[model samples]
Target: MTGTRTVVRHAPGKLFVAGEYAVVEPGTPAIVTAVGRTVTVTVRAADEPGVVIASDLVAQAMRWRWRGDRLEVCPGQDGPRVRRAAAHVVSAVETVARLLAEHGLPAPQLHVSVSSDLHEAGTKFGLGSSGAVTVAAVAAVAAHHGLELSLESRFRLALLATARIDPNGSGGDLAASTWGGWVAYRAPDRAFVLDLALRRGVGEALRAPWPGLAVRPLPPPRGLRLEVGWTGRPASTTSLVAGLHRRTWRGSASHQDFIKTSTDFVNAATDALETGDDGALLHQIRRAREELARLDAEERLGIFTPELTALCAAAEAVGGAAKPSGAGGGDCGIALLDAAAGHDIAHVRQRWAATGVQPLSVGPTPERNQE
Candidate 1:
């Protein structure tokens, strides 16, 4: 493990094109795209015996040690509580360490530095920051160990680590982070993957292809422009998702209807992408937004805020379709603008700003190490 060179990896943030809530259920597909913003991790060999992780997004240093078969966090003498942002980093390090150890290779003592462009000032824009960081960190650590993982393996490792830290996530973001470009994804069976990871070890479980994990790349629709705008307020996706779970949204007629509509939207959107049918794409986008709005109304989930409503209205005024991106109470909303609409994108941006939406300049970023 001598003379290990530094490895840097970058993973892009993601935006949900459609199939937000429904994608949480198994077999339900979501459309996601990797955006220009990214989280980058640099891993290098260190003289110390333990690993040290620092992040620009999180103003704390994470130190960890491999204790036998387990990885334990080593807080400083001041006893600072680990922030939520550190979970993904810790998860990536643990997974990588376990994989190396299981392969009879000593886990390398490394220093990992993370930086991100997923936020404006201190306000998060609801970009899949955690997923991007997890992917980047895992890739960097694995590269430092001379392990080259395929895209699917990278996705699996990120998903496994994320699920272990936050079991509620669907891993759609992780998929986009791992494989840039447009992606159609279905949530993997967590219980099965967790069992396999525990029994087969991280190295073995990730070496083989995962069953029930579907992530297919899709070409971006022609004549379509994605316009993203921030609501200037961060939303707690975990809290909103937890509330839905606590209310037993599953198995209910409303929930069933929501899923059915979302599935229809996904199919229509996929076809539209394939055929370059801008009309169909816009229609499905608006339809999906309406269905989500209805679900929020009926279930009293309050997933839609006034800001989101205004954002949709603004996009509609320009003959575009818009909706809240993820488990949205706030954060960001995305508009699918028609290239032939002849509408001034600047006008739409101005309107959005007038309504307290800050337009973001973003697009699909190339895959990690490609740019």
Candidate 2:
């Protein structure tokens, strides 16, 4: 564990292109892309016996000790409120320990520092900052411990660690962070995976093939331009998803219809992307916005706020297709514009700013390095 070289890893934040709530259900697909904003983790040998973590996003330094198989946070931290933010890191450490043990290597004493470009002024832009951090940390720590993991292994580890942190997550963000670029993702069966993890442990769960889990890479649309605008307010994805679940929308005729339409849109969009069909892509985007609006109206879940609606309208006025990205009540809205209408992005940005939105400079990032 001594004299280990520092390992640095970067993982990009994610944005949803299409399909949201439906993706939580098994076999339902959602399109997500890893953006330029990233979380970086640096892992180096520690002088102390235990691990110390410094995070710029949380603005806190925390210590954790590995006692046998368990990772325990050191008592008496400055910010109690920020403790929850460490859950993902703790899970990563635990998982990495297991991975090292599985490879017959002892866990190392390390110091880890996490920094991010995904947030502005203490406010998250709903760009999957936590997922990126978790992915980067897991990758860096595992490499530091002399375990080289495949992309699939890294993804499974990240997903398992993230699921431990927030059980309600669908793991789309984790997939984006691991795979990068544009991907069509379907959530793994959480209930089944959690049960297996509880009984056989996370390592066993990672070794097993995840039934119904799908992650497919998609070609980026040619001549397609993306613009992201933040609402200057954060939205709780957990709360929004919980509200949808409380309604028991699953298996209902209306819910089924919505899913079918969304699936069709995704398929059409996929085809449009492959063919560089800007018109079809725009149509699909608008269709998705309409369907999401219908669901919001019927459920009264407030998925679309006034700001989101105004942002979409402004984007549409310039002949681009726009919608609220992710589980939106606020956060950011994304617009897809064609090359011919790219000049209108400035106008759209101005309109969004006038409505209290801040334009973000981000686009799809490359995949994680195989080495």
lDDT of each: 0.83, 0.84
TM-score for predicted model 2 compared with the true structure:
0.94
Each model's TM-score?
Answer: 0.94, 0.94
Error of 2 at 12 (Å): 0.4
Error of 1 at 265 (Å): 1.0
Local lDDT at 327 for model 2: 89
Candidate 2 achieves a global lDDT of 0.84
Question: Could you say which candidate leads in lDDT?
Answer: 2
lDDT of 1 by residue, 1-371 (tens): 33289888999999999999888887888899999998899999876887777877656777778787555677552244445657788788888888887767886688889888998555679999989999998889888887768888888888889889767789999989998988889897777788889998887787655655788888887887899988888998878887887787788887888888898899889888878888898999998899888888877877788888899998898788999999889988999887666556777888889989989987887555432
Q: Count the backbone clashes (under 3 Å) in each candidate.
A: 0, 0
lDDT of 1 at 41: 95
RMSD of 1: 2.0
lDDT tens digits, residues 189-230, model 2?
877887787788767887887877998888877887888988
Stretch of 10 with least lDDT, candidate 1 = 76-85
Weakest lDDT window of 10 consecutive positions for candidate 2: 78-87
